[model samples]
Target: MSNIVLKRWKRTEGVVNESYTHSDGHHDQSTQLSEVTLTGHLGREAQSPIEMTKSAGEAASNGGDDSHLPNTLTEDNRNEGEAGGGVSPCCNWSWMVVLGATLLMCCILSAFRCMGMAEVVEVTVAWGEVDPTFVLLRCRQLLTNIISSCFGIIFSPFLLQLHTSSTTITIIYSVLQFMWNSSGLFVGPLVEEFNWRKVAMVSSFLSSCSFILSAFATSPWQLLLSFSILGGFCYGLMTSLSYLIIPHYFTRWRGVANACVVAGIGIGQMIGPILVEFLQKEYGYVGGTLLMGAVLFHACIGASLLRPIQNQTITNTSVQLVEPESRTSGVVTAEKKWTTVAIRIFLCVCRNIVTNFSVLKSRRAVIIAIGGLLTFNSWLNFIALIPFAVQAAGHPLQAASTCVIVSAVCNLVTCLAVSMLSDWSKFSMKGACMTSTAVIAASTFAFSVVTDIWWQKIIMGMWGCGVGSYMGIYGLTIAYYMGVHSLDATLGVTQLLIGLGFITIGPIIGVIRDASDSYTFSIWVLAGLAACSFILWIFMPNTTQHSHTTPLSPIT
Candidate 1:
């Protein structure tokens, strides 16, 4: 009985061990099946999304895959969240659009600048019957310099042909100069509120109409009404717009970009004389004036190219939210409360003006403005004095004009080269400006002593180099010192000071020429001013030496 019981126990124990082994095998198989199912589902879901994202990215990139785009979009999307949908804050196309707008602006500005200084002499010579008095000639020189420097160019063949008195023309031109300078104050707010393209289009239309209408003017006042008032106002708008647009497009290459755009002045100066000379020769002044008006119509095409940037659009939207409610109110509400709305608008404008003027409190801005005042004063004197000096030295009007063209060509080359140097080398904007001022001073002193025509031409070329360097770096220096945020206000204030110099100094130089019977005194005075500018530069601050990669912040 004991043997039988022991066998039963052994049998039961073996059976239990076999059952346990079977259960463990089934558990291992189930676990493997579950792992396979999960991997299959994950592959199905993730594969499509990855492939879709890759294809969409490729399509957006056009041809090549840009590694930078992914990171940029990621960062932008993170910042902006779902509302932006991974859109970049600034696109590749933005810089291209800015470049195209800059080219257009160059064309318009070239036409404007060329028409003022170079074409005036051609028009005066072409209309032979008009005998302008000394005062009239002096006034014309003064007004032309003032108007052109302030970014307005006016030419009415009718004024010279109709035998208008120099006094009347002078008065009209002065009023026009004032109008052009004052128009700038309104441009900053307008550009910030509306699309720049729209502003440019309106300006182009007014400019074109002004030029076309001046061709048919029968009296001096009519000419002034068309050319001086209408044209000057529109041209001022265009000039201010050009300066404002540049900073938005570039950062590291700002100096080179500005140089290229400003070089349009040289191009216009080179082309204007030849074109006007040909037109006057082939067609009379009336036909020439009419054709020039047609040429100006092309500015509208340029204006159409100015597209808004993404960052600027964002800024505009934020500003609109804070703007006076009257501007966005219903027509009936605005009409019922017209006086209140008007008061709000006036207060808004005044507030904006004060805000813009706040940039002047910066020590860097003050230094630049003072330096620019002296430099521009000397520049105006050079423009007015060079032609007279050449004439007094027994050269013809053509020779003087040729000298102007030469100076412009030299200016174009020098600006491009110097800007390139500034970008590539360790040279600071302030250092370049100081060196340029010194060169100008030396050149001006040379002009005071030199009597030979050939030597004068050489001196003029050196002077052009100095002027080009100054103009090329002026905006960049402002960006360097006062920061990019303050560029618009700094430019506006600096231009106003320069305009004052053009208006005051040109007439004073004219009086000096009449009294002294020589440009020796005038040239010496300009040299002294240029030297003073250099001295001012030496005392100003230099913030670019250390931390070259860090951007300068604007003064509060």
Candidate 2:
């Protein structure tokens, strides 16, 4: 007769969930059991959820025959399930979504980083003699893609014709930067109200419109309307939405998924300059602006790929549940009740904003935000600084561009490799952040002293390694520190910090270069910023304790 027996079989100092059927005092068929069930049985035997979950994961990973287990046991999913109060399985086709996201990310980053940065150089060249302040202001603003290709090319001629002062241009871009950064605050509510895919599609279409509007802009204010206000808002919306979509699809490969998506930024950085340069050269800036609009419009194609996952249970506490309104016996006319509904909605929104802002109260969120601010600001400066530094060291502009490409390649590779390692191995997210920041500090210091073209390329590669590694884990770090539910709010806070840094410190770097007539001091300052971020990261709270008190396990 076939019999069922519940047993915890320990072999050579490790636990394995196997059901051995014993009949007639002899063993017969043995079948593997689910890790979730195994953990529950162990839990009754006084085993902590964290310890049992980790042991089960280790056993599965350490060559245990888990072929019979469900495929939902993804890399980060274990922790996600434990913390979330139930074991959820990942969808089998999630990889298809990842592929789509990578393409979407490529288009987003290309427009946001690559095209934005290139436009600054193109605009300056087209206008031929502006205040040194214009380059500094626009370069920094464009880092987060406040300006697009069409935005700059269209505005360059108008500014020249109108004789607008650089100070006025700086003020305009500063407002754009603020708008871009502040728009993040609204993302969480928008995503909650609408499907993420719908929000992305609408924003992508509007972003393309912004670029097209810039191509025909006649005045600086028109440029602001098309490029600064509209473009900046759309970019911020799309960028935040991209980060939010990944965690929903893949818990098992969350780290690797983040790396793959962010690698699009590297790809865009590498390809954007060359493509825009060719378009502007071949078609002229006006035609280039129109062509660039055509390119930005393709983001809609990327947005179309973000299909929503079905049949998933969301246990995240951050996803607030709304209660249905009670029915009233007395009928109220629509016009009479409109004001009451509007007032109630406004009050509800205010509560959400207050609750979301409370995420900043956690030390973990603050450190993540501050560290991101320092590291990101330092890297953006490097993008603008590297070209000037190379020229200062006697290399041509071509050499500088080549060095930027080298950094991008290294960034892409390291980002992928490190993210995979973090998933497959026991490397902590905090450790990855610390190690990469140190590399950036050392590389930046070395670049300040090195003059040879080969050394510059090598130094740039090292710099990219640090930047990419940090970026790879940035989203994971947020999910780890705070729950995934708080990700939008935390990301919004980080964007605000980075934006403030751009406006305040970006121009200071330019002034230092101009006054000192050397990039050496400015480079040292950036290295110092990297060092500061490393130190700030060292204070990150120990989240391991949460595994015991809560069902979630710390991400390995």
Candidate 3:
């Protein structure tokens, strides 16, 4: 008789279903045990679902259960059972339908958000009518993104599951966005007239009735309450939720999945501003909120599609769920080439971090931390300070904006190139970290010493490249250094340090700028800090030293 045992693990640990192979075909003649009977990843002991809480820290590369498989998984499937009927060309096309609807839902959500972006610009803040302070419209966007990003990342892991994660996350995103629409347009002003409690009540009411009300108030504090209370709750929940779902279904196509979602942001930003303008112009800002509310109410229609993953159980082993005829095949299908590539890229990145640091075993934790601190600080400062620096250096606002746009585009392109380069060169993530540090320092020096507009533009472009590349590299290094499974925690810890870096940098740079008659000295000081940061990164060791350079094992 075959034996089975279960194990407790964070879902990211993909090996819950380890298969043991015999040296000889010892069981070839035994009564054939159906592979479908041994469906789950068994461990030494069965673990209750409740015990599967997430592991703490930047522990290791992680993976979790993939519910369906068409071919040999692990080069073996453990038993002799007939493959399921789903793979037969004549099989019904239902799975494709499920997948099709899901992709459509995702696309709609992306497009609506894009329209809303353009709409936000049209909101005429009665700056002249009220307290008369105008927070630059674009500044709020950056802040919203920051706040949403932090919140989304932290909440994302919690949303993962065999089913329902995507839908739950979508509802949360829609609801929060609806609330944001109301406040940014109207409730924000109304609250300026009342107490904080009243503001809170009004904001909550608008969120509850967003399908009906759509509105904000007057004072900045009113805006803060709406955003912090309603916005904070929603933003934190959705950001992480958005990225993880595609990985669940399509590990091989992580890049494509990520691209699809990111494309949503680009689309949303474009449309949102336009929507805001239309609403504000057609019926006053108040009417705009109401119009937006009308738009938001329709989203709940899509929410119904976010259901539990189909309760699928195949009595046969090795089912290949194929849907060539269905509309959803592309969105729902799996292609192994990219997944294999992903695994290799992962290996390549891990090898780099380990070989460069030379502390894989004894100093695993330390190296990951060092990677987090300097890398995040050096790169994250792009939006935080670089633009400010350019403004201080006497450049036009458009020039600063152009540099940011170009750099972001470059980073997107390098997301693939750098991953491949690291694999090809076999340079430790350590090298990448150090190179970024050097770039930051060099760029900082150039910014400080150069005065001519042309030179400054060149310097900005150089600094922007560092800024862009570092952002993507930092995420990749953190994943490989700590483990993809602990990516959320790695990101969190990195942010903690980054937050500190921002606090220290803002004032130091500001004070230096103010104290000196010109920004020259301040730029040099920033460069010096970059140099100090790079030196600190030198001691960071590779976590892979602790294990063979595969994805780091999940912390037990």
As a whole number from 0 to 100, the lDDT of residue 519 in candidate 1 is: 79
Task: Encode model 2's per-residue lDDT on 1-556: one tens digit a residue.
Answer: 3222223334221233433333345543322232322122212222111111111223224242322222222333444444333321224445555666677666755654543434546666766764555565665523322222333434555566777777777776776776676667666655543345566788888887876787787777887788788888887777777776676555556767777777766666556666666776788656876777778778777776666333322232244444455223223444345566556546644555555656665667778888988988887776767766787789887887788767767777887788677656356777889999999999999998988999889988898888778877777777666555556777777877887887888888888877987889998999999999999989885443221111221221
Off by over 4 Å in 3: 1-53, 57-214, 243-284, 287-395, 416-428, 500-504, 542-556
Worst 10 residues of 2 by lDDT: 47-56
- The residue pairs that clash in candidate 1, if any, are none
lDDT of 3 by residue, 245-307 (tens): 232222122333344444444444445545645555677645655565555434333223322
Residue 518 accuracy (lDDT) in model 3 = 56
Model 2 residue 31 CA deviation (Å) reads 31
TM-scores, all candidates, are: 0.70, 0.73, 0.51
User: lDDT ranking from best to worst?
Assistant: 2, 1, 3
Give candidate 1 regions above 4 Å deviation.
Answer: 1-91, 113-156, 276-291, 309-347, 395-399, 544-556
lDDT score, candidate 3, position 293: 53
The model with the greatest TM-score is 2
Give one digit per residue, the lDDT tens place, for model 1 in 342-419. 565466545554566555555566778889889877865676666666777788867776776567667667877886
* Residue 483 in candidate 1, Cα distance off native in Å: 1.5
The CA lDDT at 371 in model 2 is 91
